[model samples]
Target: VREEAISRSRCFLNSAMAFTLYTYPNNYRAIKSLIAAEYTGLEIVVPDEFKFPGDVRSEAFKAKSPVQKVPVLETPDGCLFESNAILRHVARYRPEANLYGGPFYEQGLVDQWLDFSAFELEPPRNVWLYPILGYMKYDKRAAGKARNDVEKALTVLEDHLLLRTFIVGERITLADIALGSALIAPFEKVFDAKFREKFTNVTRWFTTLINQPEWKAIVPSVSLCEKEQIPAFPKKKEKQPKQQKQKQQKSQAKKADDESAPPPKKKEKNPLDLLPKSEMDLDTTKRTFSNNPFPAALKIFYDAWDPEGFCLYTSSYNYNSENTVDYQTSNLVSGWLQRLDSLRKYAFGCVNVWGVEDSKGPFVINAAWVFRGPSVPFEFTDCPDSEYHQLASVDLKDEAQKAKFEALLGGAEKYDGQPLYERKQFK
Candidate 1:
């Protein structure tokens, strides 16, 4: 009797409380609320004639959103701003959907992931995507950083999804919807084949979620990224006379090209090849490190070490407080190592994470590196995680610093009083 009463009440609410989602068409953030409505069987009226900047900028719409952003949900009693908030509101109209989850604890977990999506994923996602979509001016440096951040955020998700189908419990929750919508633009626009391959679990989970009947009703279609789209500058309008002249010049250039083949381009040599040969045999040392015990490897490294030709350095992650899971922390170090593949011949090191997952962590990541040149190589410094690293030159003369180097490289049981979680080598 209670179940039937609840169903009838839901039907009444669905028929009575129609919402107006005021937003421009095809906004990814707005899609979250719409998807939630689909699950809850709520009638959300999206104004077809809604003018984007024009309508949203009006004084009438001001009450709906303070910043006059699209995706403001107008309820019977009041208005709600912020896409995530609107999503939660729509999810509440029907209690049977389990969009926010059934249990109180499950609902709290949903909120946790929603916050994660908003903070960790959305900001960097916007920074990386908006420029490509022509919503914002392109900054190469900023875009690069944003791309790295997105990958790191995805790495966290990738690790989390490895053991489960959904983010929260058995069923799809608001957390999945929030994070999934956040990822849509990225997956379709920037996450290319090679990049997507690294996060198989994330890819599988995302593919499953977006293809659902509810999600498809809102999104319509999604195409996974094939080629990465680089930030492009809009072409300036050319004068008619200039265009005609350019066509003639292009004809002449083409004729010239047909007349003769261009000379073959020369391959550029690596900068490291120009350096003076050093006595340190990196290959042998790497082999020693692999084949022998830590003590023997350290002895071999010390014997062959050339301070003038080679440089030793230490790098520690600046944001260790954000690392909560074991595999996630390990994945972070793994990603850094993968990005440094071009420097494999010129560099070697072991990166260690301290502390266990979930208990006393957020983990600590620190590493020691030996570079071919007297200074740190640009290749190592240009990796995705480089900005987060606190890099320093390791002075072997200092007994303490030398001990620290050995400890990191040898994968000591503990680092700075914390237990060593794992060590990943970049040989």
Candidate 2:
């Protein structure tokens, strides 16, 4: 199936320099390209799972495009990695599309705003908002800085839109698409009723442009909560009663003492403590293990010992057909074993597995997993075996550490059948 998809994609290689977009669904840059493609009547195919440039570290992708970022535009002439570059290329292809602008200088203005949208606006919003919304992961200090920077940018945008209808030209152009994508983040996640109310012009401009038929073709609808009034930080209140004030002072004194005192060392629990507590005694009559016990055990292992940093999927099994059952069960077991084997080395903290059911059948599927870091959900997969095998790359990163993790899994005294997991070290 994978080979067939790749072969079919090669057909694009022959045509007017096929445009392939490597993007994730929620990615702002990817969405920008999607909007551009829609306006230009171009087709852009996005890969299912988008790995971070650092994560994949693929030499081939890097060689073709130095930046190694998503929303990559692959053409017969050359590969363009950045989102803005791809948008420009698509716009230039259909100059009559009116997505860029009429005059050459107008196009330049649109380009200027596009640059500002990416460099000036998007970065700050991503830094501040992505972490808070649990999209990307970052430290608290970094997240705080991003939040402040995003607010400053928002205020600037608000000021600019006070009279202007659009960011660059009167008509919707490349600038609107670029800036609008970034702006959607704030409107969807950050701006409350109060903030929108305060920046009425910005709100009006955003509403007018995003609702346009062209933009809607790509973005569909910008997700937003009801406009909320921005409340003052550390809200004001009336003075408390005398007794309440006294109690607060006492609590503050205790807090100060706790802060000044040396932290107590924690005694680690026995390795056995890692396993889940004994299952509650349930009525077996209600839910008997109909199929092989292995499937249930596999499900339990995935549910418990999921690797901390990779995605996972469950396999479906068939009882009546030996060929189907054997192939499915073996693949499922092998996948699980491989993942367990990998985590024994470059140990992450934990893995999350999501179960997938069949489209229409009595056969309930127990397959699906998404690996999450402590901070962000990184990888996702529908193929359990593929995700399981991919763990080897992680294991190979540190041999000694991998061995230690292997010992934990193999050490019958500790893991038994429980899936062992770990957390990554944070800076």
Candidate 3:
């Protein structure tokens, strides 16, 4: 019966139809599926309209993917989410490709490696690379531990690949696709020559995989890391107290009349200070939200909100696929909010990290901002950390958009059917 079921499955795949894959550009998860398609001759269409977080957040996309994540395979039968599952679906299209391996035991081995890739390899890889790539804030101690973990995982692979050409068998299987794709970011970003020296076997195996025609077909180039890349730290600004600032002004005034004194410097005004007052009482709104539950807080917020004087905007982290560790992602949000301190008087916002951490997360980030202007404040956009976010103006007139904003602001346990992992309010 088992054998018959397997035969039936293969028969169905043999006549497999085309699939549309929804994903963002340079998504490694999509790469795995594409590479598998190359091997099995599966037609996977990635629609140009299916963009990043926006499309994924739409009602249509949510219907297909309740969790609202990507690498969703739209098949004639139904839709499939999750990259590994999509890769496996593509791989099974041509039984002759043997991407899942032939014998039952070999198939089990492939599954093992795939599980290993996800459980052991990918987590450390993400932890190590995310910081360097600026997706997560750099933490010396966390990074050090992550590097050690990656080294240990690679050591295991090194021994396994010592005498074998591929992970499971002589031919490339889903295991190779999983592990190879998992390592691509690390090898290109963090695993420098010095680091690669110890894992000669794993390096050789990885090199062989990328050089293959199928890999080359999907991924035209693979640039191995030569020198280690370091994270760029932000500079901190020191704030002086009012009394200290007044004393400094007095001291500077005395220097103004001196023979060698330079001309007084003009004080630069904030661009936002020039805007007409919104009269929204943002501080009161923040306090109301903090002090009361969702219903009462929302009522206070709605009463104070002046659509003509203020604007609502939404933003999501572009590199959320790299958001693995809960603490690290929280820190990423913290860092951004800290930089946004200058906007306290002019902005009220909520940043939510959806999906739990320490799991397979391409965690989703949803942020809602209410600014005392017609658009996003310059101070918010001017920050270096702002570049990683995809910003869009929100139309509260649209009920759906308004509800999403409310969810973020009210600290809802779930948004668009996905559970909220953490929420931070910026007042």
Candidate 4:
């Protein structure tokens, strides 16, 4: 008995204190501990002792975790279950590294974000994900609610990360590792290209975490979700009895008759299709802008210009109306532009600012715009009107139009007698 006890002790402490992690392979929650182990430089051996045919409820496995849950970690001291608990244990072992943080307050922040990730992020993500994978029955309302919850959480997270590189401090921490692991399933399954684009800050934070050596050991590569998953619904049951079928058919027919039939389709619903047919060579003009020299762009603009179908205009932000902090007001313009991005296919603008902060009588903001319609598209005008703006239409056929156009195109150093401070293009 003495020899056997010494042998077990030897097995537990080979090289660097061998710890065993019990989890089903490729489990996301299990990844938390794997990453923590990597960061703490601890060896955590994943057990293959229980295979599919073998039972997880076997006496040996159950002895470690009463619930037969995966990701139970066995240290020489004792068995640690729960992924988050295991992460805390591993990180605290290397407390001098400050994985959990020091100074009391920093550790509290890590704990708060860890809990936020679990409650706010993980559950809703599962609701949105598992149903699509056929792991749970798909309910449209439930999926929508789950998606809304996730977007809400992500929006809050985006704001937190907008000014910082990492979640807590300058570098990686338990907050990031726990949240990164929690997000992996959704990143791989539902956060497709379009969805990811909406939360640029979150994408930046996630990409940074996964590229580190600690994360790469477990998740070597992650493909941003490209295709949205469709629910795998069970087929309708067939082979109904004739009397029962007739009853169901009668019910459906009566319901259909009661419902109003949809109106018949007409022409397609593209806004560009609404224009009176034109013989203008617009496509060649656009192609020139894309594929040809600068001179060709000028030629196309001059030769193919259609005054009846398109309009030229200039506008400036009501700069004097703003509180006058440079970066804040600049962000206002950027946010407005983001809101206006949907109109990109129909609009182009050269928006410029002049003078330094509080310099030369409240820096002027001017935009030279070319829009596709006679009047400004509703999309541009739909935004709340600001009294600070000065808007005017420019007729290209006017005698001085060429000079005005040239000045705007060059992003003029002086527009209306003010020196240029900055110029941003909307193309």
Candidate 5:
């Protein structure tokens, strides 16, 4: 009781210090802020809105994050974007928090790896990963080059980790935070058993980071890709007329390609200037016009911001994933959408397949949606709890509303999971 009271008092004296990080999860870029907050003991809040479209692209959001990139830190001093900048800001938030390395030379080491993590690791990692996750079109030639690039970065780290427990000195530094987060997707999606066996030192270092309490606080699960995935479809053997068989084969192949692809590109520019001046400030407005036109790709990629009347929710197959049979997982999505008949008026979403259906081991269900009411009813989120591994609304909305509305409508293009399962529309 005494300790609780003292902690409350300490918080009170700090001017109600609170931070709202604007971005989505399982995002490596956002991890630096989340991990830094743990070390600094800073109170940070991520607006439930990230699950939707528009938060980062909105006029108000752009006002703070001019470049419109995420993991933006909303601080009392003002807004700070760029993941590295946020990491630096929070690491220095409480001088007592020794996240930034000590001594001039130690700091240089931290900066060195920070650069290596962002430049050396992140680019190739994204090229290698985004294609697999459907975030980008899978161009075999490009992906091959990307894999080679990633191997080069991993080689650098293997030599470094061979000597140190952490990426830097005695404690976890910005280097570990940055590099660890960047590695998550690649590890989960591509680095398989044989790959890890070859990089023994890198494996040891990864295990150390994954086990840290601070690391687990943000990332609950870290699984290595048991095998590398290839998204193309296999040949069919069923008997049919030659023309019919060829047509069927082509259709199925095209379908698989569509469901397994991600958004085409990143729209870094904010399309709007002053969102139509409303007497009401940003928090309450319903309609916001973009300063310029939103390309379909932009609408698809940047479409999500938390939308009013909506909450983002994700679900995964609840049963033993080991029991999964190829297209059976996609059929599960088909069934879920069929079951979501009642939500037509209130929801718009897409069901994504993270890995290739026949070869991709497990399938997770994702939906970025909005409700007709302030919240999603328990019936939708909790009733059939056992049927889903997860179901929760994270938020997004408006220039205020236009962007959110378009984003919800655009999920089909963004996730574009139609080819994986039969695309269903309740509306």
Candidate 6:
């Protein structure tokens, strides 16, 4: 019966379906989906004059998505919106490939990180990079705020890349794809030589990722230029006070130390350890479960328990009992999990599980919990499970929560002694 169903549903490659990517060349979100499609081996059709505010409101584009967003993937399956969602769909059809990953848990991780890229990193970068570079009209106050925000975000990334080659698991995944696309704007316009030099790890990771064959296929080459000389501020006519000079030197030394300090070690217990021990308490009331645990429950927990100071959105795809896992999906998932780890310093609290599967007979996940911290991002498994009940305890900078979490899971020694992921904290 499974074979028959698979045969019936097989999608034959006809003339590559018209996938209209409605975007300007410089739009970060648009480029992300476009590049993802390219890496996944999907053909993309770019439309002329479909740029910015014009494309966002065009009636022709609105037919694809009510909001008229760029990167609306028009497939034989029908129109899909959201750049990340579009990338997922395009990649899903080619699961055998390594671009995504090999397991259901991995795919979930990819989805999670892609959501992070859209939520946590892109907004401020766009605010500063776009206007500053002439991609859009400039707003001085907004641009300044954006620059500050981006610097903080970049610091987090800088710390994470210090230990790993890629964002997730072991190789490039959707996490890298999404982040690379988001970074394109700033790397090209706002992050000049000095800025890149300051974030050494980020510079190294980005340089390697973008140079990969897959990335180069879609993203245009970014020009790296020598630092331009800035005119010196006119010297004050009066001599500077000796006290002020000393203070300035002290401040500069402190800044250097702050940038060079290693990330804090992960504490043993975290707030997630406080949840009720019963499995029943973790299960979702809304979904029916088979005798076995449902896969969606894991997703609910991961999505909800995002301590990583970032919001996570669930994917539209329903968890299926018969779903086949592949390397591409797994890669994407792993990338997301790694990205989540990288942001752990900014997260707090535990995520809870609701259920998994749909109402017919199998169980489905419905609810979750997330704890956030002022400066940390959330953390999760590098490789997740589509089946089996799993719970993760993450610390987003709360010592008490970390202690509790460690107690629940035996001891801090059992888990990686170091914070699973480390990122720079910006004051």
| Runs off by more than 4 Å, candidate 2 | 1-18, 49-55, 135-145, 227-427
Per-residue lDDT for 253-361 in model 6, tens only?
A: 9998879778789887654443334333222312322222434544444444422333322121133221121221222233333445533432222221122222121
State in Å the error of residue 321, model 5.
40
The C-alpha TM-scores of every prediction are 0.55, 0.48, 0.61, 0.52, 0.54, 0.48
Question: RMSD, model 3, all Cα superposed?
Answer: 8.7
Q: Between prediction 3 and prediction 4, which has the larger TM-score?
A: 3
Off by over 4 Å in 1: 1-10, 234-427
Question: Which candidate leads in lDDT?
Answer: 1
- Model 4 — TM-score against the truth? 0.52
| Candidate lDDT values, in order | 0.83, 0.53, 0.81, 0.72, 0.62, 0.53
lDDT by residue for model 5 (297-342), tens: 3343344433442344543443423222334444445555665665
Q: Which window of ten consecutive residues has the lowest lDDT sum in model 5?
A: 281-290
Whole-model lDDT, model 1: 0.83
Model 6 residue 184 lDDT score: 70
Candidate 6 residue spans exceeding 4 A from truth: 1-16, 49-58, 135-140, 225-427
Model 5 TM-score, 2 decimals: 0.54
Candidate 5, RMSD to the unseen true structure: 18.5
- Candidate 1 structure quality by residue, lDDT tens digits, 157-258: 999999999999998989999999888988998899999999999999999999899899998789999998877877998757977999999999999888
Q: For model 2, how does the per-residue alpha-carbon lDDT over 77-169 read when each residue is reduced to its tens digit?
A: 778876677888887765556777878898788877776665566655665565556543444555566566667766887888877898766
Count of steric clashes across candidates, in order:
0, 22, 0, 1, 26, 52
lDDT of 3 by residue, 135-196 (tens): 66677777787788889889999999989998998888999999998888888988889989
Off by over 4 Å in 4: 1-16, 52-54, 235-427
RMSD of each: 14.8, 20.0, 8.7, 22.1, 18.5, 20.2
In model 4, what are the clashing residue pairs, if there are any? 318-388
